[model samples]
Target: MLYRFKSQATADLVMLVADAQGALRLIGKDLTPEGVISPDQLPWAIDILQHAWREDNDLGLREDTYATEQLAEQDDENPDVRLSQRLVPLVNMLELANKAQVAVVWSAS
Candidate 1:
């Protein structure tokens, strides 16, 4: 899976990928992308991404629950303030997409 972030806050873009085993692997040439999302921010991002994926793909509840739990654990050790800060952009992204009524595309083939 792959994710891309584009925003006015920074000139560079952010991209992340996950391998077949669900291990996240950072990609793209621009490491210091404008948005500067840290590894700590990834779980929240993944939570959103996975929710969209499951909804769009009509995934089973069991699968969704398992994934959600796993992703939630990623932020357990993070400071509350840092987690809140990280989630702000993610929530904004979701709101922006929702306002645009964007259709989340899924590939479950």
Candidate 2:
């Protein structure tokens, strides 16, 4: 899947993803130039993606806790509420990772 961002602050940035044979599978175009992201920053991007993917696929009812908490805050006490709270940490980590990646890229030029 390609992700695109557009803003008035800068020119567009495009990220092209291809297969081993250089076959283009995804193209993230028109992305607000978050600046020049280098290959060295890929590790952190991969880390963030991996973590988010893991959290999304978590089957141990961990993420459910955060959802549960959210519902509980509304005074709806359901046992299933415990399953929703885990999203908080997952979201926080993802945000941090994104910011780090952006910072790295923005600092480039």
Candidate 3:
């Protein structure tokens, strides 16, 4: 399954359900069928996500829950994709939505 995030301020964003859920979980959101992040909430959401990403990158504390040993090994042999990397697009979308005073919404499919 996939989640499609829409924002009046930015292009539509699509992500695998796992990736979207991982990031949303950081901000205390569940991967429901649909949801919204209001403009007022964007700053806090962005902060939480960026902080978690930084901590994961700098301290390597959080396990990449989506990755298995086999995938980890494959990543080592190829270009790596980290939680931090996966969160960037979502963060960018939120930032833009905040600036434009619009809401960010997502629906599971």
Candidate 4:
């Protein structure tokens, strides 16, 4: 399954099932079929994502022992780079949506 998040403020952000689920979890959402993040909710979402990112980095999962084969070959990237990149846009999306008094929603496909 795939999860595609959308908002008028930005381009669509598509993520794998596991990745999407994990990110939703990070923002304290259960794995539901679909949901909306209101502008009122975005500030907390941003804080949650930021906190989770810091905690993930603190784990040092980018180290050789914890890294996967692909990461081993890319010395400059962290193990969570892909997840983080996928979500960075969300942070911005949430902020923009907030300013515009809009919402960001995700659908499963």
Candidate 5:
């Protein structure tokens, strides 16, 4: 599954199931079929995500929860790019959306 997030404040942000759901959980949300993030919630979500990006040394929940046997076949030239890398786009999206006071919505595909 994939989750595509969108807001009037920024371009759409797309993520795979594990990564997207893991992020939702970070802000204390369940993996629902559909969800929305009000601008007011951006700060809390952003805080947790930045914390994980700085602290988690492993591939993180994003990879562990989603990776399959075939994941082993993929090269890890830069495993660091897996979970933490996603923060960049998300952070940018949340920050901009927050400033614009727009809601971020997501749904599975």
Candidate 6:
């Protein structure tokens, strides 16, 4: 599955299932077929995403032998990169949508 997040303020942001689910979970959103994030919610969502990103970075999972061993077994690409870097585009979309006073919507396909 793929998720496409759209906002009038920016280009649509597309993410794969694992990434989309992880990001939405960080922002307290459910993995529904479709959902909306109003402007009022954008700030809070951005804050949560940023905080999670920081926490993920501070943990330094890439350097941990245990974490590295686990990462090696996953089919996904670069756990370190996916954990935080993937959130950047969505966060940027939320910020832009907030500035424009528009809602961001997402649908799964």
Clashing pairs in 4: none
- Compute the lDDT of residue 73 as modeled in candidate 2: 70
Give candidate 2's TM-score.
0.26
Model 2, range 68-89, lDDT digits (tens) per residue? Answer: 7677677656454222243333
Each model's lDDT comes to 0.39, 0.36, 0.86, 0.77, 0.81, 0.86
lDDT of 1 by residue, 1-109 (tens): 4445543333322323322112122212142212333434534545655554445345445555776777687856532222223334444554454445442221211
Candidates 4 and 6 compared by TM-score, better number:
6
Assess the local accuracy of residue 91 in candidate 1 as a C-alpha lDDT between 0 and 100.
45
Report RMSD for candidate 4.
4.4
Q: What lDDT tens digits, residue by residue, belong to model 5 across residues 1-109? A: 8999999999999998988888898878879989998878888887888888766635566456666554677866434455677767887888888889898899999
TM-score of each: 0.27, 0.26, 0.81, 0.72, 0.75, 0.80
Colliding residue pairs in candidate 1: none
- Per-model RMSD to reference: 13.1, 14.3, 5.2, 4.4, 6.5, 4.4
Native-structure RMSD, model 2: 14.3
Off by over 4 Å in 3: 60-76
* lDDT score, candidate 5, position 61: 61
lDDT comparison, 3 vs 4, better candidate:
3
> After superposition, which runs of candidate 5 have C-alpha atoms over 4 Å from their true positions?
57-80
lDDT of 3 by residue, 5-98 (tens): 9999999999998899998889888668999998888999999999988976764433444445557667655535777888999999999999
Query: Between the candidate structures 1 and 5, which one is better when assessed by TM-score?
Result: 5
CA displacement after TM-score superposition, residue 70 of candidate 5 (Å)? 23
